[model samples]
Target: MPPTEAADTIVALSSGRPPAGIGVIRCSGPQAFAAAQALAGSLPEPRLASLRHIRRPGSDMLLDEALVIAFPGPRTATGEDLVEFHCHGGRATVDAVLAALVEQPGCRIAQPGEFTRRALVNGRIDLTEAEGLADLLAAETEVQRRSAMARAGGAFRRRLDEWRERLLALSAQAEVAIDYADEEDGETAPDLRPAIAHLRQEIALLLTAPRVEPLRDGVRVVVAGPTNAGKSSLINRIVGYDKAIVTPIAGTTRDVIEIPVSIGGIPFLLVDTAGLRATGDEVEAIGIRRAKEQIEQADILVWLGSPCEKPAGAIQVASKSDLAQPAERGGLRLSSVSGEGVQELIAEVRQRAAALMPKGDELTLDRRQFRLLGDAEAALTRAASLSDALLVAEELRTARVAIDAISGRAGVEDLLDSLFGKFCLGK
Candidate 1:
């Protein structure tokens, strides 16, 4: 049975590929059961699988023998009656099944993330959880999976809630002080000066966390050094594959070769660049320029020669330990070919990336979040700069509005669309 209040039933291929052992077609919304019936000829028991022949509409054409499971409304994903058909995996079979369902009135294709969006709209999950679900689906490493799981489990939401509560408390205190301005003992009644200062400092501290970047992404590491330092070989060893061309030719790599690899469950963009050197050739010059650009932009630089040149404000790593004697300058020495100090390098990378943002920190994950947090941070900082309580209150309100933008508390429809609309269909 479908819930009368449910939305229009939508269907999509739940499992991506076909021609496998099984294929899954998911339908959600009010008419989910009806759509399933049009294809399966009968509704399967709720949450239980039953074998049936899925046929095309107005014809005896058998799509495939499949197992059907029906979930009644308010208990399934999207809080609507959802149906699943496990058919023999094949593109033709799945498409035929979907076509039969969509041919029915009130049945339509589910848009990308429509199912998850329904869950969010129906109060089954929050925005943070929705983001986590997406992350979980896209996670490629154990660390990424764990982080996404933590986020999906509402750890991030709890942190956001705590930050919001602190701000709310401080705002309430400021409001009281503003309202009681005429009281003889107004200064002592609400005592917002200390509270506001505390809240501002706490927010400022949280804004320093580095997890903001790697929380949903990976770090970028560029292997840069003078020629013949085994840059390509090191990259191959790190990734455990012969991805980059390795040879004895000097300046062989004339362009940036970037590979997305994970170490110790930490994702990193490993870039092998043209040997950094004085070059006059146009192509080599461009590669050198790009190498420097990557070096400047990378989270860490793996310097691959003796007497490595250090980049200011970046971690320096000395590679090719097998050839060079144990001479320490200011960077860690490593030999990717010999697997020496590789474990330590991986650990250092994880630790440094983690150190970017401290735990319990709440900052923006992308440029949008950064801008919003920056606005709020700036507002609060400006407010703190002013000693006047009234001005402080106004500034606090402005900052609060900025923070609200990040949490969708201020009704940011455009932001929601931009964030959630990128998800795949049937998410």
Candidate 2:
């Protein structure tokens, strides 16, 4: 859809699909109350739920018995008049209620994310908060939930506002210097280097923040090494099930088998890849290539080998420890069958994963926000080197615009569709 005002009333099944105890249908727009009153006899006081018999418009047919609530706007979620119908979650009943709602003159089915889009357009939330809401809805791990919640709760907004305020102040000072350069006293421009340098330092810290994307998308940990090294056995033990097939054959496993495991509440994709070695078999060669790719992309690589074999720079694990006693190596030694030292191995993995996570209370930005921040940082860096007051002020303004884009104050028209397009219907 194009960037335009949302003037029509939209109705959608806010609650997920049928066969539950209750379903929520939300309506937002100018005619929200009228639409709800048409199907369900009369609405209770605003924000109060009233039990009523919902029916087909202009007919005696009873659709369902439901609880209806009205929220007069400028105070509701969408900042518009809204109503909700809490009805039985049976598929037919929910469908019937929606059918009756759409029959109203100004009511129509809501598009994907229309409710949240309306919320954004109506100034109920900013771009960063909206993105955080999206992340919260899709979060799969404890750390992901905490990060998303913090962003959605306006932590990032608060930090961005501080930076923008400082930049605005500096820009104003530069403009004043240019305005007074010709004064009788011959006043010179104030030194802005200190403030500019401080702001740059802040941006630099954010740029180097611990990786947050991996926390959202589960970290990949690939088990790699030569064939018959108990790689599959280790994966199965870690996942606590038979996820990958293990056999006596040298090259039985010929593909990457991935299973998600959470250690210390952090999500990880434990991948068992085909053993790495030179092979003439066409299928085995393909598997080996895929294994190499997985290793390159993995956040952590576990090199599985015998006690006598070792590889540099990988978290070495002595697999099949029951067959040969491991020497005093720096890496871990565990037997998948006997479960020796498995907990220790998991603890080590957890420590490494935690090291990669961003510290709590730190401002985290998604890809779009990070890119804009980068632009602002570059502008500020350029501004620091300029001698002319006018040029410095112009660069500061450029930097300010970039910061504004993160919170939807400017330059967000083109991004609306793609950003909200990922949300499920009815928000």
> TM-scores for all candidates?
0.64, 0.72
> For residues 1-427, what per-residue lDDT tens digits would candidate 1 score against the true structure?
1222245778888787777767788988888888788888897778999998988868998889999999997876788888999888788888888888888878888877778877766767667677767777877656566666765776545665676777777767676666666575635644565666666676676566445345455577788887777789878888888988888888889999989886665567888999988877889899989998988767777776445366665555677677766656556677877888777776776787666532432323544555666777787777766655677778877877877666556666665576567777667
Q: Tell me, by lDDT, which candidate is best.
A: 2
How much is 395 displaced in model 1, in angstroms?
A: 4.3
Q: Model 2, range 1-427, lDDT digits (tens) per residue?
A: 7663577899999998787789999999998999899998888999998999999989999999999999999888898999999999999999999999998988899988888888878888878888888888898656677888877887677778899899989999998878876563776778897789789879877877655566776677888988998899888888888989999888878999888877767778898999978889999999999998988877788888643554445688877767765455445778899898788888877878777776654557666787888999999898888878889999999999999998888978778888788889888
After superposing candidate 2 on the true structure, give the runs of residues whose Cα lies further than 4 Å from its correct spot. 1-5, 141-143, 180-185, 205-210, 222-265, 270-298, 301-349, 358-363, 410-419
Residue 220 CA error for candidate 1 (Å)?
A: 2.5
lDDT of 1 at 177: 67
Note the clash tally of each candidate. Answer: 6, 0
